[model samples]
Target: MPIDDVSAGHRQELRRGTVALACLLRLRRPDYGYALLEALAADGIDVDANTLYPLLRRLEKQGLVTSEWSTGETRPRKFYRTSDDGERLARDLTQDWYRLDAALRGVIDQGES
Candidate 1:
């Protein structure tokens, strides 16, 4: 049976918000859209192009990432890298993620106990 639409939609929205942070965290090295999508999938992010492409554009607009067209390949591709400002934000977000995860785990453990 399929999950209720409301619950699935909510989960998707939550996952959508993390795409930027995940991209910022992963793009320490320059990567093109398809390659970055692969990397994100390999790391279990599971995002679709519909979600990622617009997120990339938005991040670029926000000055959090920089991109350039690479002509070295038969098909030119735009490679993106996190900006210095993005790096700093990623570092702070990483700390926050760790703390939040630990706190949530503690609550789960307390409930279990």
Candidate 2:
């Protein structure tokens, strides 16, 4: 395979887990799916609706997120927010992410030495 193809696959793999963490953190402030997508994009996390919607559903199912319909708008939309459990999970995951990042930096520095 070409270098671009190989890099794309690795990038996809690296990003796969970050999406869930990003969603949980972003949804701490209630938002509908499309708006959430925009917000995430603005924050530099690019996630497709196909990927985000299903992740939201799974998070809701797992009790990590709560949702309610807003009917006051011309068009009803379901808004989602991270639950307390989700906040805890996000905290834990963030700490782990930092630790992993530090470890990776150390490995890279060692390799360069």
* Top-lDDT candidate index: 2
Taking every candidate in turn, the Cα RMSD to the unseen true structure, in Å, is 2.0, 1.0
Tens digit per residue, CA lDDT, model 1, 1-113 = 36798898889886766777899989889999998998899999989988899898988898999999999999999999999988998888888888988999999999999
Candidate 1 wrongly placed segments (more than 4 Å): 1-3
* Cα TM-score of candidate 2: 0.95
Tens digits of lDDT, candidate 2, 1-113: 99999999899889888999999999889999999998889999978889999999999999999999999998999999999999999999999999999999999999999
Off by more than 4 A, model 2:
none
Best by TM-score: 2
Query: All models: lDDT?
Result: 0.89, 0.94
Q: Which pairs of residues collide in model 2?
A: none
